[model samples]
Target: MTSWVDMPLCAVDTETTSADPNTARLVTACVAAINGSEVDSRTWVANPGIEIPAEATDVHGITNEYVREHGRPHDEVVAEVVEALYVAWESGRAVVAYNASFDFTVIANHSPGFEVRGLIVDPFTIDREFDAYRKGKRTLADVCEHYGVRLDGAHSADGDALAAARLAWKMPRVYHVLALASADSLMESQANWYRERQYSYIDYLRRNNRPFDDVSVEWPVRTQKATAA
Candidate 1:
């Protein structure tokens, strides 16, 4: 049996205008392919067609003026990114991301009619499942530290994406059961894991008298609400 670490993997990450995936416009995106000892990466920068808020620019270091002057058009970047993802999917590789739901959702929002294929390996979701009792943060950098993976250039899409891929590659070694499961099985487990986590959060919110109950159980991509015609 082939170890999961040896399998071809595609890691994706994106820098956006805001934290809300539904409304955030992509500022930059990266996709990294890892197969055994070989690794390749591609990055895209787009104007986003909106103001890249000061806070967001500070985080990713991509200013609106910089993108306007050097970045590709939004639609062009989206098509290229989507095509890269599709190629990875078609090649029987797992698509990975730190917080996959956010990146996948942002891509879906931008790609519109394009369909997202392949099994998604979310290192963040997997870490939550395997280390549910561990305290403190689970940000990409935090998880990288926990897994002994080096994550440099924290907010840059290329750096983050490659780090996420390395983290996913390390997960199965930490959790033996994950290494035994097929990619499809892992994807299904992540869906269940996300739902369970959301329910726990909702319960905590309700117990604390907080009115926060709009969380979605969907994995990789949350279902978008229909707009009024």
Candidate 2:
């Protein structure tokens, strides 16, 4: 079987108004396509239709004023973002993201009743499953460095999207089992990996008498805005 590293991948990254996908709005988004040696990308900036909190702006450096001046309508930008993902799926490419659950959930919520279908490649989930004992943060930058991949921009959508693809591309090269596996199968395995990790965390919380009510096991996407603790 051909390795996914040798095939095209459509990686997406979104900067939003909040951490919770349920209430967050799209502030900026990028869908980056990696076809072997070539990289092509599209980016979107949205007004979000609400204030971008100071904390959110600090993370991505995308201010409400900047978006307001440059953005299209929030709904229109979301619709086009989803359409772009659809195009990737239609073209038989896996959709990649760093923390896919968050980005994908934000897209799903912003477009109500929309079906987010595709073979999803989540580098975050893959790392968690494959490198279960490694310590320290798995933020995209950290992961990129851990895998010896360069990330020029930390929070920009295009940079992160492309970085995710690079990180994912490196994973299979590091883990031969993944190199031999198909994206569809690996995505399914990620679902199980996510669930297993959530179960372990919940058990830890229970043992330590901490609240785990908001710990979600959803992989790739969550259909609704979750009130996580």
On the 0 to 100 scale, the lDDT of residue 117 in model 2 is 71
> Which parts of model 1 are misplaced by more than 4 Å?
1-6, 224-229
User: Cα lDDT of model 2 overall?
Assistant: 0.85
lDDT: worst 10-residue window of model 1: 220-229
lDDT of 2 by residue, 1-229 (tens): 6555555788999999999887899999999877778888899999999999999999999987898799999999999999999999889888889989999889988788777576888888889998999999988888998999979788999988988988877888898788876666777898888878877887888789998777777877764322232
TM-score of model 2 vs. true structure: 0.93
Clashes of each: 0, 1
lDDT of 1 by residue, 65-141 (tens): 89999899988998899999999999988888989989888888888786767778899999898899999999999
Residue 143 lDDT (model 2): 90
Q: What is the TM-score of each candidate against the true structure?
A: 0.93, 0.93
The CA root-mean-square deviation of candidate 1, after full C-alpha superposition on the true structure, stands at 3.3
